[model samples]
Target: MTRFNALLLALLAVAVPLSLLAGRVWIDPFDPQLPNAAVIFIELRLPRAVLALVLGAGLGTAGAAMQGYLRNPLADPGLFGIAPGAALGAVLSFWTGWAASGWALPLFALIGAGGAMALLGLIAGRGGGVLLFTLAGMMIASLAGALMSLAISLSPTPFAMSEIVTWLMGALADRGWAEVWIAAPLTALGLAVLGLAGRSLDALSLGDLAARSLGVDPRRLQALMIAGIGLTVGASVAVAGIIGFVGLMVPHFVRPHTDGRPSALIVPSALAGALLLLVADCLCRVLPLQGELRLGIALSLLGAPFFLALLLRLKRELA
Candidate 1:
């Protein structure tokens, strides 16, 4: 695990510089003639890359933890509905023309996440099993998605509707230090929460009854999962607008290299996710098109095929 983590760290070190240099107007770092190169690196590309690492790490960690808690390979952080809840909040901000305020959008989104978390707790209730918790999450996700759609349809102006739609597609474009500040601390705290739950998740792999016999507290573990995933996914959505697939896809990439323990998988998944998102964002910037590709779209394009392949593999195994 140490070697694998070290390898990932080494790869991330290489990828970060490439991400900084790759864009429509590529920077020749060695050349002294380039104008405003420092500004571009510091102001434009740096924050975007940092935000990718932060959000990707959060998503990846959350994914590993979720899959472990559910004991299902297909589980994702977004399955908990936190991301959709945050998106609904952001959409509401746009709907009401409050997004123009610097902090209103993220603040609204966080409140929405809190509401979803509260609802999830209420619906799941104490002693609710994993199945019930999952169902409650699905319910919240459905309700949030419906609400977001309603907001878009009832938008006061076409411009507002357009803004909401575009934001939903997701991007790191035009993001700055403010986004980094908003997401980083929340993501870091989330990662810590998930780390503390690692042992419980490992016990959970032995089945709920077995986990209980082994001194695992189901309610405590559930709370940790909810809080960890809520902070990580909510913060990501608050900053990046609904970037998907990172949580769903990242764990699979790293699981093979680990000992198949959730605790073993989390850190490696985080590093790999950071590398993947950074490279993908760089690709979005460098692609020759009228406009840079949206980060969410690019990941979806990659993730859809990957998901299909995974399903086919599972079918063969089942067969």
Candidate 2:
């Protein structure tokens, strides 16, 4: 499993750079237009690939942390309503024209995600347990999605409505180094926090009573872990809108290599998440289509089927 993870990481190292060269505008090094090509490479292509890597890893590691803490296979930042809350914030900012204030889009999105986390915790209540928390997440996510739909339905103009729709669908198009810088640091910090909590998560798998018997403070661990996820996944949602399934799928993909150790899944899932998104982003560039496929749409097309398969597998296992 360790060897497999190492190989995957090595492949990702090569894949990310290759993705920069995958766009529709072909760059010839020997051509007289090389300088223009270099400009495009530096400005657009590089940022897009870097974003897929950073944001993807953020979602992945955040999901792993959430799943480990909850001891649930269905746990994910998106599923838990964090990303949708962020999306609602960004969409509201755009719709109401409040994002004109400097950095309001990302700021509002972060606040929204944090708000959703708080709301979820509140609904879960004291000692509510994982089942109650998961149910609360579903309710919160549904409410957030409904509110977004309401905003779209009440949009003042067709153009505004279109913008809302496009933003919800998500894209990495035309993003620049500024977006990369904004997301990268927040994600890195969150990942570091989650990494430090890895041992705590391992203890958690033994159940709360056993973990406490071992001197592990389960509540403190849960709070810090949730905070880490909010920071990391919120940054991703702020930048990328609502790219789902990376969080949900990456941990499952790496589960085998982790030997079922949820803690061990963290780094590998993060790496795999980045790799998957880069590959998907590369396909968005090279695939023949009427218009470039949105990253969110492309991911949904891929992820939805995997989700169904996962459900079926669970059913069979229970059977």
Candidate 3:
């Protein structure tokens, strides 16, 4: 592991325990008199923390891979339409009252992600350029977003509308080992797939013709990106609603510490993403609000400013 990776790992070690102990009702790990400490730690906090780690790593790695693949510093995993597609699925679950079922929501979300992935591949076609691929993804995202809005507008009941809106805001409250089980293996497999495409991403960083000359197969790389991103981003939305920006912001935070190669950036970005999400979730738990803040809203509040700063920086550089 790189020093950056080691640093993130160390931070995570401290943060995980802190997250478990710090919540609306604080627990004293050392206090033998603390009631239900084990139950709180095991039944509630542990799974939520694990889910944060898994999903954050997935988003972070996806963001790094996306920026490298498109050669655009501003690129995000959501740009591929997979997230919106997944969100649409989750919204549909609410609209149809299936969200009350244990597995229906996630299953619908995964199916939506798969549909988006298939559509992206189909529309981009074999040998499509990066620009075409990106545009196709954007189109799908727009479509999915529209569909979700329509679903909300036509929701059969006020309760369904309320549920849909709240879920779209995103949070980790009440999640359990079941959610962790659903997301962990998928994210791990997605990470492995992205890692396999690392060398190709490095080559593509040099531009399309140059990468082709270097024997990087665009079709294969594209497939890997779609599959990897689909699984990671899909599983995340399936389990945790629509937590955003980890993928977009994480790579930028970690990139300066790395050698600036896409291959070298992935693992460190994953670690940093995990750390960022874990800490953010803890903050959400501890904040003295009417209720815990939504994880998606908190990140968007942080990321929108970060994104604006990047735009300003880019503008200055271009000028």
Candidate 4:
């Protein structure tokens, strides 16, 4: 398993740069204006590929952390309310014309995600148990989702509706280095926090009581994990506007190579996530559909059944 993980990581490292180059070369195929392609490469495809890699790594690592902390294999940042909350924030910002220019949407999204985490923290009722906390996560997500739906329903302008729907579905089409610059630092910080807490996550797998018995402070670790996941997913949702299932799916795919161990989960998951998103984005470009395929739609088509299988497996384990 370790060997497999190592090989996977190496392949991903090589593939990311190659994928960027491949995407650039493929963008305007059969064009006689090959000499002017440098501007296109520098201005468009390069940034898009970088965004995919960053978003994928952030989602993958955060998903691993969420699952570890909650002791639930099916956990995702969106399931815990962050994505919907962020979406509401972004869409509302756009709807109100408050952040009509630049990256104001993503900034508001981060604020919305933070607000959701804060609300959940308060709802957990001053150090609530795991089940109570998890329920709070669900409640907040549901509430945010409802609000987002209402906003969309009430939107009168076609342009606004189009923008809202496009972002919600998640696409890397027009993003550039500016978006990359905004997301990169936040992702790096989130990864650092996750790395620091890896041992704690490993302890958590043995159950709360056992973890405490072994000198692990489960509650504190859980708090840190939530903060980490919130920040990471918030940043991602800010930029990508809710690319789902990468979080849930990438970790599951990588778990085998890590032997189901949390301590070894982060890096492998990050690599697999980069691989998944790159391939997904590539497929989006090549699909025969009239409109561009959205990342969220692609992930849903690929991940929904996998999520169901995971649920069945969990039920079996519980039984």
Candidate 5:
């Protein structure tokens, strides 16, 4: 399984770069303008593709770690509430004119995300129980989402509303290398932490009691895992907004190939996630609309129905 995951990672590390270079003008059979082609490739397509790869890899790794720690295949990065928390932080920055000033929004968004995770951790660990910790994280997410909506409603500026809505939809359009540098290191760190914890997660699959008997401390590892996932998702969301379902969907794509093992699922999920987001971003470029579609909307428009069908199939299998 590990070998297979390593293979998938190697494949994607190559594919993402080639896909970043692919485009309409360069790939077209009869295109003639060579100098303009360089400008478009460097200024437009490359950045979008890089953003997609980073965002996808970050969310995918976070999702894999969350599912393993929670022992629920359906779990995602949103489980920790960082998405809405970051959105709200961004909204606050826009309303206060901070986002207009510079990169303050991303900075504030990270703070908001970290704060929300900290609150969840404190509440859940009040008595040192697993179920309560999971329950607390869910509650924090729901509450943060509601608060984000409330903040939007209460803001007086109409322009603020439009800006907030556009951001929440998620887009890689017009983003530059700065967004890449902002997100990539955090994603890399988060992935490294999860990779080191993979053996711990494998022990966790045997249930917490079984893990404790084997000398793995489930509680400590869970705390670390949740914090690591929070950082990855927070950093990604701070830059890209609430891109949904990648976390939910990527594990589903990787699990069948990995035979449902936590250790095997992490890296493959990252690779599959990078591939999925790059494809989605490319579709965003070629869509027949005047304005580009948000990656979140594109993903939801496509993934929602696929997920519904998947759910129905699962029910039938269970029966």
Candidate 6:
């Protein structure tokens, strides 16, 4: 796992720079012939690359924390209403033309995510039992999805609906530094709060009684975990537009190689997530498609097979 973390560190250094050097721009790195090429590189490509890395790392880290806490590999912020709630916000923005200013979209998305989590907590009440939390999240996710569908269907213009749908497919296209700045603070704060979550989760692997004997309060950890996931994942969704599977898949990709130690999976999982999204974004840059490929679609195309293989392996293990 340490070696894996070291490898990821080296790769992270190269990932952003290489991604900046890519995109639809055909300028040679050595020879700057295109007018405003440098500006384009700085103002456009640079931010999108940074957004990819930041958003990917956030999702991966949140996913690892969630799986550790819940003891469920499939546990994710999306499973709980965060991603769908953010999507609802983005959809509302498109429907009402609020995103014409570009800044309102992410802000709305963040608000939506926060609202969903708050609503869940209010309904489920104190003590934060796992089943109650899970159920509340499902309700919120359902509500958010329904609202999003209604927004799309009721949009005044067909073009607006198409715009919403395209954005929902997700991309890092033409993102700016302002978006990165907006998402970074919340994501970083959440990451810091959950920095020790892996170790806590290691303790939580024991039964609740055992964990309590060891000074681990499940309720406190649950609250911290939820806050961390909400902030990190909500910020990622606000910026990245519902890029799925990275959270659900990254820990699995890194876990087996790391001696199957749950706590040790966190850092490597995040780095692997960064690598996955960076490569996906770079591939989207070169694909010969109208308006380029959507980042979420590109990821799904890659990850669906992996998911199916995982299912088959689980089936065999059961057999």
lDDT of 6 by residue, 1-319 (tens): 3887998889888877788778787557888677888898889887887788778878888888877777777677687787898889888888889988878999889988888777876776777566787888898999999999999889999999999988898888878998899878888888776776666788777766666788877677777776788888889878778888888789888887786655787778778877888879998997777778889998888778877888898789889
| Model 6 pairs in collision | none
TM-score of 2: 0.93
* CA displacement after TM-score superposition, residue 238 of candidate 2 (Å): 0.5
Residue clash pairs of candidate 5: none
**Which is superior by TM-score, 3 or 6?**
3
| C-alpha positional error of residue 253 in candidate 4 after TM-score superposition, expressed in Å | 1.2
The lDDT of each candidate is: 0.92, 0.83, 0.94, 0.81, 0.79, 0.81
Give one digit per residue, the lDDT tens place, for model 2 in 1-319: 5897898889898997788777888666557556578778889898999999998888888888888888887777776788888888887887788766758888888888888889877887767366777788789889999998998898877887887888778778877887898899999988998887788888878987887788777566756666788778888888878888888888888887767877798889889988988899889987888789999999999989998999999999999
At residue 137, candidate 5 shows an lDDT of: 75
CA-RMSD of model 4: 2.6
Give the TM-scores of the predictions, in the order they appear: 0.99, 0.93, 0.99, 0.91, 0.91, 0.94
Alpha-carbon runs more than 4 Å astray in model 4:
23-33, 312-319
Clash pairs, candidate 3, are none
Candidate 1 per-residue lDDT over residues 171-246, each given as its tens digit: 9999999999999999999999999999999999999999999999999999999899999999989988988889
Candidate 3 residue 121 Cα shift, in angstroms, is 0.6
Candidate 6 regions with alpha-carbon error over 4 angstroms: none
Residue pairs in candidate 4 whose N, alpha carbon or C atoms collide under 3 angstroms: none
**Count of steric clashes across candidates, in order:** 0, 0, 0, 0, 0, 0
Report the number of the highest-lDDT candidate: 3
Candidate 1 ranges beyond 4 A from true positions: none
**Can you write out model 4's per-residue Cα lDDT over 1-319, one digit (the tens) per residue?**
5786778778777876666556434645557577757766778777888888888888999888888878888888677787788888998987887657887898899899889888877887555367888888899989998998898888868788888988898888788898899888888888888887788888878887887788877567756766777778888888888898898988888887666878688988877887888878878866778877888789888989999999899889889
- Compared with the true structure, model 6 gives a TM-score of 0.94
lDDT of 4: 0.81
How big is the positional error of residue 36 in model 6, measured in Å on the Cα after superposition?
Answer: 2.3
Across 1-319, the per-residue lDDT of candidate 5 in tens digits comes to 5776777777777766666556544443256556676667667777777878878887888888888888886677887777777777887887777888658988888888888878877787744456887788778878888887887897768888888888889878778888887788887887887787788788889888887787777667766776678777887888888888888888887888886778788788888888888888877776778777788899888878867877898789889
